[model samples]
Target: MSGRLRLSLQYKLFLAFVLIIIVPISVVTYVTTKRVSRQFQDHNRDLIRSIMEQMVRAYQRYGTSAVAKMEKASHSREIQEISARLSLTDSLGTTSIFEALTPEQITESAKQVGGPLDLDVFTILTGDGTIISSSHYPERFGYKNAKLLSIAARQEGVPFLIQEETANDTILTVQAIQRIALDSATKSLIIAGGYRLLRQDFLELILSYGKASLLFYDIPKKAITRLPPGRDGNPTPFAQSPDLLKLARQISEWPNNPLQPDSGAAARPELQAEISLGNSTYMFTGIPLIGVDGAGLGVLLIGLSQADLYRLLRKMTMSSTIAAAIGILSALLLSILFALRVTRPVKELSRAVRSVALGNLDQTIGVTSHDEIGMLGAAFNKMALDLKDNREKLIQIERVAAWREMARRLAHELKNPLFPIQVSVETMIKAEQRTSTEFSTIFAEGTQTILEEVESLKSIIKEFSEFARMPKPVFGPTSVNQVVKQTLLLFNPQLRTIRLIMDLDDHLPLIMADKDQLGRLIKNLVSNALEAMGEQGSLTVKTHLGSPKVPVGAGGTSSLASEGAAERASGRGIEELPALARETWVTLQIGDTGEGLSEEAKQRLFTPYYTTKPKGTGLGLAIVQSIVADHNGKISVDSAVGQGTTFEIELPISQPSLAGTETV
Candidate 1:
């Protein structure tokens, strides 16, 4: 948790914008693409089903036209004459139509009628369903046409599909049967005619309507035949495509009573499936082809290529991705611009506040807008101006109060000396007037007392003048430990009866200070300590590098290095203080195990002309305070009534030049 990174306003804003813009766009693009792909697939399925329906309609029309042609051929003169002859009986009842006409004449007659009708097969059947004469297959003359016989018995003049088999192959045809009336003694004769339906031709016709593949399932042979585009050869077996095979099987298993031609069963529902062939995929619709008598002939599968639809979807997805990227980039750019615009004023305000904290109380910042930031800037400027004015007034009041105190203390000291001098001079005048023998002695003593008192007044005046005329510090790189060691030498003889402890850090860095002024400050503190200790207590002095005091918890203090202190100072997180301001300090502490001063005495310890000593002029600690302040340092004292006293001073390792000092 302590190692967590701090994010600035600009980056936070950028992230927010990215999530807000990109998330919805991504979601919408995904959903829309999916929906479009699904719709495209559905449309393709419908198209395949529509194509199959068109083929079925075409086949029905072909069947209807074929039936009409056969009906027209039934009434033709050649067919009528052949039927009339077939119905005619010989004089002897045992002779039939076959005996009445030669086989050549009978077949030739059927051909003459079938040629104009454009029929593939024209045949005359006996009452028992034997092919008496066939126009297309003369060799089938003796074969029985059982399908025709049953269809004739049910209903004649209606077209129905039939399969005629030969040694080489099988042929499918749409044929209509017609019965011609004869005498009661002679049985009725039947005529059958139809046009041949080649599977290849039918597939070709279906393909001509659209760009699709056709698979014909032969129910009898249990085989699926594939008719691809632009192939003129016979259809090949299509066993590799499992999807198409499944569709074929599903259609073939559809419930229907094929034997009941007139049962009026409901039409089968169209089935659609998708199959892949080679590198391309297709959508197939299975259409069941029904024979005329409602028999399950086979399933005709029509497939429409889905390559175009897939290609379109791919293009759409690519387009969507590119668009999303552009949108995100645009959002990023806008977010950056916005974040900079917003944070610029905040950064300026921060710098201004730092300047104010560093004692530049006249700091002012520009107000660019009427927004919250601008309002804050305006408030800060006002506060700075007010503070500067107030500080000037307060300084003036403090100066007057200090001068009043100085005058009162100086007057008090002057009164004490003036009284004695006045008394002595008066005594000397009386002695001279009396003209006694002891006049000389009295004069000598009075003169001596007067001189001594005069000297006392001069001494008090000199100390006051020195304190008032204190000079500004000449800052330079000076080692605090060296100065403490040098000053301690002056008090060595006086410290013979006292236990002296010195803890000076060797690694302490040099501080910017006046060497002479630092010597004086240390001398004053040591003098005070020796005076308070008198004869027996220990006097201790220490010099070391010091860090800022940081608050650890409630009512607790912890010391940390400059870097850590600066970071801790600004609770907003990382360090906000300038590097120079956060530099380390050198500390000097001097303590005495003497009768410590009371709290009131400690409070006014550095005040000028305040002293606890009977004959002391209290300017030493005050002078020390002034010197410390001149070097941009701080001083503090910790004391108890009887536990002793200690003075701690902290000075920066380096500092900017003093405002009115000459650098050495």
Candidate 2:
């Protein structure tokens, strides 16, 4: 996970932006939701507490009022009259009334006393705490179940109040004990009355606080009974509201389930839990109901539904998720734009650098901005201009040097012939003074000498003129091997001293060329070979068709000045000549076995006015170069010291001539 974080600047920036936006949003959303939930919890606790306090006050107030009302009813005038009647019946006869009056009569007497009170139960008890007759429970006719009233009788004017639990119901009653004085003996009759706590009334109180109810665990029944349906709606059985029931059971059975009897607070019935009911959620708190005697009666389950809180939290989460998605997408788009804007200049600079490496110094980057990249581009442009200027200056220097060398060689050649002519003329002038006797012979010799030297000077001048004004070649089909054969024939006489070898391929193709130029090109190479051999070594001239796949190396001699001149005249550099000279070229190799040329000599071998032999015109190889150039051909020399020299010429097989004009 950490390794993935080590990404490029663009990605890192994107990640940074995402974290910056998303982290805060996530944290805020989470905190807000949690805080809201906590606050709801506090609010729920306060609400439940308020409801319980209301219930406690209502219970105390209602209970006190009920007890007071019951005491008033027990001492009512109607009750007193019924009491008087009971006293009269007893006074009639102690034994006779006891035998005649049935339990029904006792019940009638009690009802007549307490009937105006509209009580749920009315009963008569003897002074011995025996139930004589009951208004609601008539079956309790003879049971000694009036201990509550008997105790009241002992208290004189005080009435006894108690919550009586029976087999079928529980009721609250107030008993008024009155002593009846009689002739036979002292006797007492008690009137006890109260009302049942109906399930309907209890439920009404329970629902006064929001969807709440009372659960009473009947220990005898071993099951929880919902008192009744609350005011909100009909109460589903505890079996039906499983979520609520399960929690209620757990809380009710706390000490027995998860806590020991001595676990103190944990054993005490105060439970708070969240439950899911159907699709809605709720939070509830349970409180135990204790009697005045400090005995557990049942639990008072107080529930505050949490469905609204859950809905709020879910909505917040969804909103946060949506915000994060939008933020991430926007960040990604912005990062891409920023990255492109930042790297554009760098990419342009890189391209310029590549162009410079490839020797394209003229390539320039646009200085569109006043940033670092723009400054770098400006520097590069300045460097390219400087390089171009330096190259031109160097070419000029070499051109001037070549011209100076040509002038010096010309002067030296002309000086040689001119010096002899001057000396011969001077001798003639001196001879004329000597006498008529020897003047004729001296004059004749002088004239002959002058003519010969003049001829020599003319030859030198003519060679130079020819090199300067060399003619262009006229194209025609010509065999290179045939031309070599003819040139070799012309050198037949010199071949006797130097063995000649011809390795011309008979299958060699014809090439577009000038017959005379091709012959002259071959003749000069053969002549130089013969002369270099010093009349004893071998001279080999080989001709064959060159391979069309690979390019053959062919060019003028190593003299930059001469080669540059040739290229300029033809408007083609040595490297540019390949367009005219195709791969399907005719090759001619002319070699010689002799004291080979030094590297320096070979370098300038074909340069105009450069020659090694005395009395030799250097125009021969130069003329040959011009002729090959005119024919859209290339010429190159391969030679090593003591290993002789080989001159190879490659000409396109049948390219048309550039200049259509023919010159003889």
Candidate 3:
């Protein structure tokens, strides 16, 4: 009632996809977004820390240079040399500076000591803290500067000085109080005057430096200015950064004790990490440049920012997240595509099978891919066609089998009656009862005719019954090689006239069958071969082994076995010449050298009682065909008009019981 269903799997798959794949993917996308966000933050923080360390290193270099400047200012070696020329005896003694050096020579020596520590203002102080050197102005070098001298003298070894006023910024007053040499003994005197702090190079250095804010103060005139401090305690850094100067009161004394800003102080340098300048974060560092004599001269302050660190981190995280998402999405999409491509065909084949389950043999799984799936689709089509054809063939075979069984039954049932009738007819024909030539001739002729006809009738009934009622085979394990050998031996007498060849492989597995049926199968084939060859022709028996074709249950089937031997042989009997036909069949190929029949003769060869021989019963071939059918074997006659005939019989290679085949 159904016109062939032409629906494709894609239509059904549309429904299947909704049920299986689409919904879960939506949930996966939602989960992935949240996971991506958390990973971004952690990645950026690590990048910022690395940039901060680089800034720290740069700050350290500027600070160390300031320390070197302080060392040059405070070596104290030049001060010791100046003190060596002067003499003083304790608080009451005095020594003549003129004895060590004239004014011109002293002035020249001062010029020779060109640095901050070796200044031209080389002067000597008396034991009573009086300046005695002529290098300073006469009024400026003595007790008139008692306040500065007393500061150094009272401190004994410490280089103490008050700041001196200058025309521009200021000068340093370094008065290192020491003992003056007198009669190989020491007296309380002091050597001073590296007070001229404004070396031009030093001034230039103080101005060029940034970050280290300065405060230059003149103790004499109290002239204070925000001058940037140098490594030496001079006016440097005070002018560098206005902000640092504004916060001077707080930062002038750096590494400030307790570190925190003073209470009620106007400016408080709270030592900030100056996070950034120009969109970058920076660090502010302060290093104390100590004099060689261990006085806190001044400080070097720096600001190093790291905003680039933050920017780099932000860029890195954003880029990394985008790249990661793209990669993961690409992988996911490709995987989905690949999986669907491979499984699509399998699903199509599955649906096609379901249609077939409902007895839709015309349904086909069309080719979808060039790979294995396409091959499977073609194979399915072939299998469906084969199954449909085989189904029809089975019906025809059943009819043939039924007819054969009936013939065998009829042949069996009538043998009892046919035997006695034949006996009576022979006796009647033998008894003499002729009176006249006409009467005697008529009686003998008539009796002979009746007897012959009855016998013919008997023969017909016997062969038909035998053909119709074929026997069931009793099966057991028997060697196929042995069966072939024994059957050929039985035909040994006939073998003398015909050249025989045997090509059989040993080590063949045993087959299951009934012996008498198998023997009769062989007998029919051999007899047919003898008839085909006429008198002397070659006969060859070949045997080969392979895996048995057992029935498989698949594709709406429960028992799908191969076409077995007996019935197949019976069917093939239809395609033989009428002359030498039929026999019971098995897996024995009995070929003969003789003139063969045409295609037409081959087709009608196994029809009931069909005969082509002069004196032979056609029932012999028919009986052979029926017996072969019962045993599930086949007999096929392959021949050409002039060529010899080959009757290839394929039997179920099962061994048959010896008792069952005791008589064929």
Candidate 4:
């Protein structure tokens, strides 16, 4: 689970989409389902009320017929005869005298009475409001029921009236009252009667209304009776719908005031609740059953199965799951495609970088798009081309340096014999012009000049040979400062007009170098300085040890870093230079207070056979550069027009031993 939770970008995005798309859908589905259930409850309540409304109307019609029958019975001839005899015997015309009637007499009289077939209650009441007898409850003879007496007393002169009453037996009924007049004498006796609400017809009427499971709760008795669904003869008993009945029972117990809708305040009955019974679900609700006079009799419970609702919700869930699956699948596929589209170019660029690392500067990638990746490819190609150009330049520079060395040697070799030959020929000519001059003297002088020129030729050849066959150096711990001091001592007398300044650091460390070669390098720089000063200017030679913490440029050693980097890149094998070059490097600077060189001359200052002076061979500085390079050192010149020139050289104290190293 933890591993799965470690999210990649694509999966994280997919989860985000799932939440965005599926969460709202799930919430909406749940809310909608709840709303639908509420609607079902409200609609069912309305339906049950509609059915109850019709049931009340049916009960009212039954009461009306019973009232009509009671009224007719009161007007019968037999009832009139009895009322006349009774009235003649009472002066006040008080019907309370009828209390003397026995229960057997009342039962016998009602047997002969003609009235409604379903008369639930037949009673005789006196004019002063006393129940003489009730055919249904004959044991209550001579008793007074205030509810019945009130109906009899309130019947002033009206022919008949109806009222609702509940007897001591808890039988709820609607009664009718009427007076029997004995032939217009204004004398009469009151008769009251009613039909009980517990009749089978009443229950049948409610059950016939709808398919809702019904239960009649007897409020007074605290008993429950299920009104079986369908017709009376239908064998399907009410118990078959136990789930519905169970739900109905539960709804009946909720807080309710059915008799007076607004009379009581408890928690309003739960409008709807789900109930499970025998593998099925049902929605339950309740309605109050009240008597005609607004007395709460019982509750009418109704149950509606929830099978259809579940089916609807299940279908919705399945559809949503499938849709979510499709959405996530689509997101995953698109994310994969997008990741590949972005990474493919990066991989190609990586390969190109590797090619460059392996010194293959010609490798380039195609710029397929105008995006950042394409821009990178274009930049890579430009870099490769630049490197290729720099390599070619370095190679050309090496060739020029080689050619310059060869020309310097050739010039030196040829110039030697020519001077002497010219002098010898001139001497012979002079001899001929003087007629007294001896022929032998002319031959001897001419030959001697020629021989001298031949020896000079040999010396020039030896110099060339020596340069070409330069001996190697023998390394040792030599003081560079001491070498510079010795070279200054040798040239101090020769430099008659030149003012010399020596700023050498006595604290410089010993370097592994050839003293003879070091002396030659310093002599060449000193000679050039004197010559550039035109026989009368200051010459400065400064020597110091470089600091490790100092950067190359700030310390006048940047020439080594830049040029060494180029040489290393060109495979010149300068990588063996000591890492302590910064701190252990011995720096020498030669400055001349004379006419400075132009930029072109500075660039070719160390090129053999290239000189700015009329009598200069140019090999002097060239030889100095070669000696410094052989010691694994760097040399550079800084010059500006009209300002003097300065030559700086840096040599390491220790370097890797070379094969041809030898000491003089």
After superposing candidate 4 on the true structure, give the runs of residues whose Cα lies further than 4 Å from its correct spot. 1-6, 20-24, 76-105, 108-116, 128-135, 155-169, 181-188, 198-211, 217-307, 322-664
Top candidate, metric lDDT: 1
lDDT of 3 by residue, 199-239 (tens): 44443443343332223433233234444444554543222
lDDT tens digits, residue span 1-664, model 2: 1233346667877888899889999999989998999898888777766665554444444445445544665566644554555466544333434564654475575566446665556666655556665667666666776555545446434433345555455433433344444333555555555544333554466567675545554323334555564464333356446656566566555433111123243223246677665665666656444332233444546656787787898899999999999989988987788677555555566656534432344556666656665677677778766765765787589558756876787798899989888988988899888766888888899889899999999998887776666666777878887777777788888887887788988997777788988888888888888888886998888777753233333332332222222332232333343444334667788889877778788778777777888767687987887787666566777777788888877676754323131111
Candidate 4 weakest lDDT stretch, 10 residues: 568-577
Return the TM-score for candidate 4, rounded to 2 decimals: 0.44
Cα-based lDDT at residue 182, candidate 2: 31
Best first by TM-score, ranked: 1, 2, 4, 3
How high is each candidate's TM-score?
Answer: 0.62, 0.45, 0.36, 0.44
lDDT of every model, 2 decimals: 0.71, 0.62, 0.49, 0.62
Clashes of each: 0, 0, 63, 6
lDDT ranking of the models: 1, 2, 4, 3
What's the lDDT for residue 387 in model 4?
Answer: 78
Q: What does candidate 4's lDDT look like per residue over 1-664, in tens digits?
A: 2233465555665667667777877888789878887786676666666654555555556557766878777766656555655665533222434543433555555534534345767776555545554566655645656655554565432222223333343555655667555443644456766665536676666556444555555566555556552354222333334554454455455444333234442223345556665676765566555443345556555556667767887887788788778877777776677556545666667656644443445666777778776787778789878877886797589758766767765776577678778877887877777764486787787898898878777765664555556566778899988888888998867677788888989898899898998898888888887877876889888888873233333322223322323332222223232354346577888999889888677666776768888744456776777677667667766677788888887776775333221110
Worst ten in a row by lDDT for model 2 = 655-664
Q: lDDT of candidate 2?
A: 0.62
Error of 4 at 295 (Å): 5.7
The sequence of per-residue lDDT tens digits that candidate 1 reaches over residues 56-118 is 555555567666876787688876675666666642122465676676666686788777777
